[model samples]
Target: MNILLKSSVLCASILLAACNSDDQQQSQTSSQTITESKYYQTKTPYQPQQDLNKYEAIPQGFQPVFTELVARHGSRGLSSIKYDLALYNLWKQAKAENALTPLGEKLGADLESMMKANILLGYGVEGIRQFGYGNETMSGIQEHRGIADRLLQRLPDLFKTASTQSASILVQSSGVDRAVDSAKFFTAELIQQHPQLKANITPMSYTSLASSSVPTVEDGGVDRFKLYFHSLNKEQDLATPLSASQQAIYDASQAYQKFEEDDAELINKLNELAKNTQAEQIAMRVLNPLFKPEFIKKLGTTGYIFSNTGSYTVTAPNGESITEKGKGKNSIASAVDAAAYVYELYSISGGMKTELKGIDFDQYMPLDAAKFYAEFNDANDFYSKGPSFTESKNVTSAIAQGLKQDLFKQVDAIVDKQQSHRAVLRFAHAEIIIPLATSLELHNMMQPLPLRQTYNYSNSAWRGEIVSPMAANLQWDIYQNTQGTTLVKMFYNEKETLFKSSCNYARYSSNSFYYDYLKLKQCYQIQ
Candidate 1:
């Protein structure tokens, strides 16, 4: 029987080689062990033949038993072969490159062992079935069938156990339940029951002789082999029995559909967890730096202070004085002397030639006696009293209206001068103070996060003093339009600050005279 199977395998191999040159070439070059034997040689003896008419039907339970056995072993053999071929090719390529490591060699050996076990188990079942009694002669067949029937009833449970175990292993290995072990188990079982009749089977390495069995050869081997070979040819002509259990196993092994769904769910869950963890980590990293005592200490310190004098001074609250009379004498005394000198100069230039040092300039205006007498006489006679009969009552009313108009014109001029003077003072204040104040505010707001550091404004302020001595002029211009309404405009040098500050207090107003005041209030609120 073995010889006949070997001849059939040889013929099949020849036919396969003729059809697929690439497969034959790959098989030859591959380092994977091939377990070929004379088991397919038709000319060999120890084969038996039986007449189809005399042999009874393979029993009703035969299909299911064959299917269960095949499912349990065939899949295992195929998976092992695949793994061996892949590992062998990898090692062979690595060896060619002089890169074969111990790990690679060990993996190759493991795959080889797996393949050997699969092949032995696959063919061992075939050897027992073909050489030993069939279901018609062996009473053990009924018992085996019963066992198979029981196994069939528990198929769902068996599959669940295998799947769970395989999933656990896959998760530990790669965070994915690839079901590789389950696939192997199924492959081994399948190969066991539906062993390819003419395929070669090489003996596997047994751990102990107690677990190994040797096949016995019968006499009249050559003739018997020919008879068995001819009988296989006739058996091929008959309809093959198909098993439903085999189909079910095949369906279950196609795990791609379930794997894709499960994998998506797992990956999504992991990604959500990772995202939350990263956000928390960033918050902690930022918060940790802020809580450091050094940062808090630095923040608590006072900033730059603006003193009144160009140098320095100590003032007593009770109006006491510390008089140091030298080159660094009292600043207040120096300022008073300067003011007196200016008053004297103004008086001399105003045609008051007489020296009047004792006179109080604020209360009395000392002048030349001749000029004063002339001015007093002119004011008494022409300017002060002579407007008595210049016009009629209605004409005087008209004249009074003209005089009121002239007085208003002079008042407008004074108002313009005062506004211009105030603008200069406001610009000076903004230049000296705004930048320092705004910078400090921004520093405080951003210190809690480590996004910014303490600003070094000492150098910047010093540089500004040298270059402009002003924070850079900030001007608020107010004007009246045709509607007798006031409009306000703010400018920093040439740049407008009106709406650019995004400060509510800095809003433009076209109706109220108090717009600049409102804007300053808004700026205060923003800060």
Candidate 2:
């Protein structure tokens, strides 16, 4: 099959499976299909996208040998109190002016309720807990616990061997509380689910495991390309050009803004028409009400640089002309900040029952808005944490190299005779998973966000919702037969995934999601 064709089919399945029946039903009945709109919601606190039962069965008679996973920390509360405080101030101002819609009026009480809940959760007024901001929620704990149980069920032979041979399960995480907490919950549940394995399990927080927070590029550990990846985070003002994919998303966002501002009635009409006729504007319409008009425009302005690429001269206050590179449309911290606040409210509202009487604010803030933010956030990440077609080709390659090093390092340890390890679990933030997926060239991560077209389902392969949602994970299961033929099957966020086409393994066809271990090692140059 053609790479694009195969990619489309696989990506469609993965994305669709990420949604449950309600999401599916909403997609079908709402203004746009998930593909046509292709919005990504960042940290919107959603459940697992893929149904574990629907996962493809392991190929017949392939008993597991070594297994490992790199996972993003599970769903968590907002990273800071800033977003909440910002919106709360806005809500207060809006209330003072009586500018809030009736639904908006309910927000004042809701905000108070959310504040109290956070206080009770030990966040205090500063949103600081013992673990710090953005720590995992209880739901986050259950997420890893559930994932642990499922993995035990999926690879019975691996856990069985660990029990029989007294093999140890090595658990490592970034020192960050969320990542550390994720590793803790996962192992605890793994042990609780299968108590026999507890004696052999050893968990630790390895600074090296948290590559996302500190890529350690300064140590001269990363190669030339890896250095480029490290530079992206600092070269915020670098004139990084956008690809065709990036351009498309930018254009669509522009169009959405244009329609939103100049022809509001038209957008409304289109949305109304979409509701009845399944028109594309329906998704846009659904998302339009989530924000006040001013904030939406602000977000649009902040997001512009990601779509269109170039540098312009800015006149300093001292009347000197300074040629500054355009890192993105908005400053790094401000880009999608509004979306972040909106998502924070969404999560906060989950705890507000009594205070939310007259309004269904969550419905007003549909998944479409989250998807739009997700797309925007992914664009920001594309430069900072993901591979893309940059003016400098080396950016993504650097991070990919770093992650490949970590992957092979773990793989070598797992396969080492002295270790006798059944599993290796490494937990970190979305930063690690995104770049690692790009390095691995799995599914949507393989395609660069284009420069000229909107990154809807049809044009681009990347979908942040499935690729790096909270609790997202990538797993590699090594299997060997009695004849000692070892093979590897990879899974991204629980869905079976194929290696990049360039690294076609001898054991599996291009369409096959499995690969020979030796071929994979050679393809990745995993020494």
Candidate 3:
């Protein structure tokens, strides 16, 4: 699907591609292994983890009754012009000194195009600023809309019954603009396919609405306290505040903060790891193709200038743009970091595929470099968000508790017939998804290592791309047979995935993905 920079068409899900015979599923799945370079990069776009047609068969007599999904916001622009602004400054320095090689010279156009595309992402042809600032990119809309289409097909009866019974899809979000925008696009597709759902929903129609930055109580779907439960104040998650009922949630957040502060030993280990992992040799290798040797030496010697935490901009004469007003931080950093600034653009460019096409920064950074950086990036995330500390899951569990419980509570309501909502979808960020994934031990995310062992490509399966790439999500579908037998199944990125190892399905059945709902609670140690 093409994501236009300024003017664009609404490229929804490609359903025809999803329908393949079961025989082709294995070959397609094997072809896209995690070891493949395409899957390794952060810019990897959302691919449904499982082929829609090949998911394990639903047990006979079972029908899907309730569904819930916790999705990371869709692909989006850099939070601000941080990467573009930083790289623009570096590119200008190179141009002034005549340091740019043919490859290096291309950075300017790519950055500009990327910046413009980001400025216009999901903004329509006019490129309005309010929703354009770090908002969902066009590819993101495609990802969610496509998922909605696949979902409607997967559980056609649930939606149909919900419409007939007047059951609303109780929506929830982190309340951040991108996440809320994702929710909007997703629900829009649902209504587009099933007009009857219109009467069952809240009065506000988000799918057709313009992007918004305003915090809203209007969506009724938004419950920041549960969806935006992370304690990390460094980003937009804090935009949504805590209510009195959420006051207990603070105890967990405080505990996390206290652990990070008091654990001088762990801090020392992490610091030690950071000092050695620069991969300066690889940095030089990347820069060699882009700049002259003398220029590299000078950068290595003098360091390069970055900025205080803020976004910068380049306005067109046409007055087209998004958020800018960036304040430059006149700090010094190593030559490698400056090169990484290029890598940053290259990495983020993956999400911009729908908007900015045919731009290749991958030529600048080698696959090994990309892999190194991917791991380097994953290491830090391992501690801050993923299961940190080999011994305990303190960091993530604290923040993720509410989200996990929210899942349990909501699903229980459906099972017990307390609520008629067929699908309870929640939109959140990677922070929420990763923590919840690690806390629940989905994939190999449970492996939090000692600081010395550290997270790496070889040792840890907890990769950012596979774990929570653009539009990362975890969906739970509940099915029941008329005999009162309840079963649950999970789809990670829409692929059929098993729960924690202890969680067992019917051993005799051909399907490995389905699990007894009551046994699932016991496996996770849920009361």
**Structural similarity to truth (TM-score) of each candidate:** 0.15, 0.64, 0.86
Q: Candidates' lDDT values, in order?
A: 0.22, 0.51, 0.67
Order of quality (TM-score) = 3, 2, 1
* Tens digit of per-residue lDDT, candidate 3, span 122-170: 5552112254448777777789989999999999988988787654677
Q: Would you give me the overall lDDT of model 3?
A: 0.67
* TM match of model 2 to true structure: 0.64
Tens digits of per-residue lDDT for model 2, 369-448? 54433444444344334554433243443444555665666555544544567787877767566767776766634455
Worst 10 residues of 2 by lDDT: 1-10
> Which wins on lDDT, candidate 1 or candidate 2?
2
> Order of all candidates by lDDT, from best down to worst?
3, 2, 1
Q: lDDT tens string, model 1, 24-102? A: 3222421111112111111011111112233222222211100111000000112112223332333343445545344
Off by over 4 Å in 3: 1-32, 39-43, 125-131, 203-208, 211-219, 232-245, 258-263, 300-323, 330-332, 505-511
